[model samples]
Target: MAIPVTAIFDIGKTNKKFFLFDENLRELHHEYFKLTPTLDDDGFECDDIYVLCNWIQNTVRKITSSGEYQLKRLNFSTYGATLVHLDADGKPVTPLYNYLKPFPDDICDQFYKQYPQDEHNLHTASPALGMLNAGLQLYWLKYTKPQVFQRIRYTLHFPQYLSYLFTGQLVSEPTSIGCHTKLWDFSRNRYHDWVYTEKIDHLLPEIVPASKTFQTIIGGHAVKVGVGIHDSSSALAAYMMRTQEPFALISTGTWSITLNPYTKESLTRDELNRDCLNFLTIEGKPVKASRLFLGHELDHHLRILNDIFHKEARYYKQIKLQDSFLKKIHNHELTPSFYPATIANPLLSQDVFSSDNWKPNNFESYEEAYHHLIWGLTLLQVASARLALGNSDVKKIYIDGGFIDNDIFIKLLQYYLPNYTIEVSHMPLGSAHGAAMIMQGKQVELVV
Candidate 1:
């Protein structure tokens, strides 16, 4: 008998990736596609819904029809805080609004007044963020785009929307609902009263367990489909399944988010100002998380360095740094502080690094220059990671994603976080893989 295979659609803003995992949660084969943007009737840039639906349908068919593998199930893991509004016929009334589009300032102010910013933050377990908070998107549409909002029958988070395309079910997963949406009341474990107060309750789908299986017949194959999960929560699931002990995870990509699963503390005013957020696990428990645009900053500075030195930015392999250069950086006394004034664009600058001078002198090799640049980045990452740790006792720091591929970045992180054991994750397709694991109804060893 052939091993059972599960397919997953892992959707991101820039990339739509597909993965096939066998019964053991090993990746069998994977492919990725990019989404093209189309303007809606109102001339607002939006995701091409038809293209995505078609892609899902064709992909499912392709997987089932392939005689090489025994297809048994399917699931989805996607970026959070974006939703799709559907009509009575289950057709989208408008293009899927891009979350990157800014929410109106006045509307947010109105929400703050009614709920009180601090209380609302406490209730939702999510600090207020403009468009990133999915609930504000609904408010924006209801008040500003009244006509469009009225036509909506259901508002499904992006992940559930994809699952709905496959199973014809309208349900909410805990992870997606609890993410900075302002829709969920984490303390109460239900939708906030404001959902009905604003008459937007009908927009939300019925809540479903992330691990719930929705069975369907595709291409004459009986496949079990999952409700879908938030990308971050899914990533956490993958990590949790791998380890049985308490640990903190730093998932790096376009945005580097540090997540501490053990910390159940509420957000403070100061923490909120630093962009700290509380996310719900797939099981509906709060996971303390803070984000830094470390990847974005690294990319930006790399570009700046490349432009200035007229050389391509490459990885700095291990090489002996001159004692003099090391002494200069180490001996220079610098106080650790959050100097917001030095930040020209805090959102664009992922690394909290400030220096009077950063000119590169002629080094023996490119490795020396690379070390200097990465050392600066590592310092910022370490500080940001500490903020995420908060009052928790994290014994191990699990580093995952693209940062694991960078040797210098990992080494620097190891150097700074010497108190904790730094273990690099070996999981492939972490988010999608975790979603599949949830559907499989089993746990596997976490080999890092």
Candidate 2:
């Protein structure tokens, strides 16, 4: 007999993954692929929309028609800060623009002049992030590519666009709209005034509930298709489901994000200035969050360290928890020297790390030097996490994603945040599992 399964497409910046989960959500099978990006008309590299779209179609057809497993449902969780523009006839009008693609400085300056700094940004809970503010892409299009913009029928966030490929439905959900995109006004619970005032809202499709799903027949079987969700918000779903108490999730990958959903404070200018922003859950509530480029910075630091230490780059993995080093820190014997360079967060300056920037000359061995590196990195991590942790009584912190494997990093985190119970998350399939779970349950209410 064939097994009944649900498929989830979990797409992040570096990898695209497909996973099959059984009735109980145990992963039965999984595969990953990397799409070779193509250059857009403006010479900036972007996702090969046509190739990616074709890949999605071919993959789904193979799965549905295979008949080895009953395909009961499907959903997507994709990175935010991307858009797929479609024309009147429901075809892509331009390349899927890369979020990191530079917005012209002159144009960006003009945008701020119109919207202004605190006046417009504070209301949306969005920080000034150049092209990272996905909504600004609309203005970039209207002003620079009017001919291409004029033909647009609907502009879909990438996840919804992926869902549309299967069900032919256009949707806007809070998870994508609320992701520092400068599109949503959290207080009013809708598009920001600038979006409507500028008439950029016209290009947007009607928003569907994040929980909404469509039933469709495919390959002689009926399937439930979800409305799609942003990857970060979707990743938080599984944690939100299982944990009964208030907690913070430090989801680490290319970026290390500290998310606290229990906070009552509205984002202040000070918080926003430190790269602290808000993300909406699938249910449309704020997940007060902070960001650090610690993951990427670790890689960069390792490359430099390997060159200096004359060892294989992966040496850190061999070092277990440094009990002797911990004693030094605990006894105030290690006057830690800091390294100034860390990965840059767009919303904040590097000045926060400079005060303690000490040299690595004092270390006798690579292990000692590595400990120093982590100590400096932890300082930045703490600052980012504190943005969301302010005045909250969250007694537990759940560290998820890649950094959970780093004992040194986790131990430093525990030492720094001794007031909280720190534990590594057991679930690596957070985003995919979260996307699938939302299909069966009632909407989760945020903790007050």
Candidate 3:
């Protein structure tokens, strides 16, 4: 007999994954792929939606026909701050623009001037992220490409778009809407006023709970298809289901995000300025979050250091935190902070470290310099994490993703947050697992 299973598509910016889990949520199969991105009309790189769509359809057909498992359900967990615009006949009308693509400064300046208080609007929980705020993408399109915008009958967040390809259903969910997209008004619990004002709300599909699914027939089999979820929220859902206590999650990747689902305090403007925002759970409750460009900063500086120190790319992975090195930093024996004490800035900058930004004379060895880098980032991370923590009496912090394997990063975090229990999460599959759980209607309520 074929084992009953659920199929989940966990799509990240660089890695697109497909996974199968048996009835007991045990992994049955997993496939990973790296699709080459295509360029937008203006030559900016973006996801090739057609290529991704074909891969999904082809993968499903191959698996369903394999007979190794019964594909009972289908769902998706994808990166947020991206959208796919569809025409009236449900055909894509534009490229899947990269979230990092620059949003014109003039338009951004004009937007704030119009909605003077929006920058500090806690109700939206969106910072001035320009293109990173997906709603502004629609605004940019409407103003710059009115002809293309006119053709857009609907716009679905990346995850929902993937779900729509299979289920043929048009819908939205809280996880995507509330992920610093600037579309959701958390206080009002509806679309933001700017959305309605710009008439961008019309292009958005109907809103649905993240756990809601549609009964569909796929490849001659009945399937429960989820509306889909943002990757971060999906990962948090996995922890919420198992962990009974209130805690913060430091989900690291290109961006290191500290998430606190238990914070009761409202997001202050000061917090917003410090890069703190809120993400919604699958249930539409706000989860306070703080962001830091950790991985990006580390990668950038590591390249410079590798050249200066004549070390391999992966050398830093083996470096561990040394107490004596940390003590020098704490005792002010190390003159001039390598990275700025500013929590909102990147992990490392030349501004405060040395005159030319980087000076080889600052350190005797590559390992010593690496230790300083980690310590500096950890100092900023402590502040960022505290912003998310608020007054919540959370005693545990779970660090997940790429940095979990970085000993220096993990150790420094533990040292800085001595009052809390710091743990490295082994759940790299948390997002995929969480997507499956939502499809199974097994979402557990998390009490703060």
Select the stronger candidate by TM-score from 1 and 2. 2
Which residue pairs show collisions in model 3? none
Q: What's the lDDT for residue 140 in model 3?
A: 92
Pairs clashing in candidate 2?
A: 338-358
Full-model lDDT, candidate 2: 0.81
* Model 3 lowest lDDT segment of ten: 342-351
Candidate numbers, best TM-score first, in rank order? 2, 3, 1
In model 1, which regions exceed 4 Å deviation?
Answer: 1-3, 39-46, 309-329, 333-352, 355-373, 442-448
* Leading candidate by lDDT: 3
Steric clashes per prediction = 1, 1, 0
Models 1 onward score TM values of 0.87, 0.92, 0.92
Q: Sort every candidate by lDDT, greatest first.
A: 3, 2, 1
lDDT by residue for model 3 (1-448), tens: 9888999999987678999998778887899988998999989999898988899999998878988778899999998899999998999999999988989988887888877755436778967887889888998998899999999999999999999988888998888988888888888778878888888888888877888888888878998988889988888888888889999888887778888999889888878877889999888889999888777778877887899899999988888778887787678787644554323344223323443244544688998778777766676677788889889989999888778888888877887788999988876477888899887767534211
Cα lDDT tens digits, model 1, 124-171, are 777677778998888888888899888999989998988888789998
Worst 10 residues of 2 by lDDT: 346-355
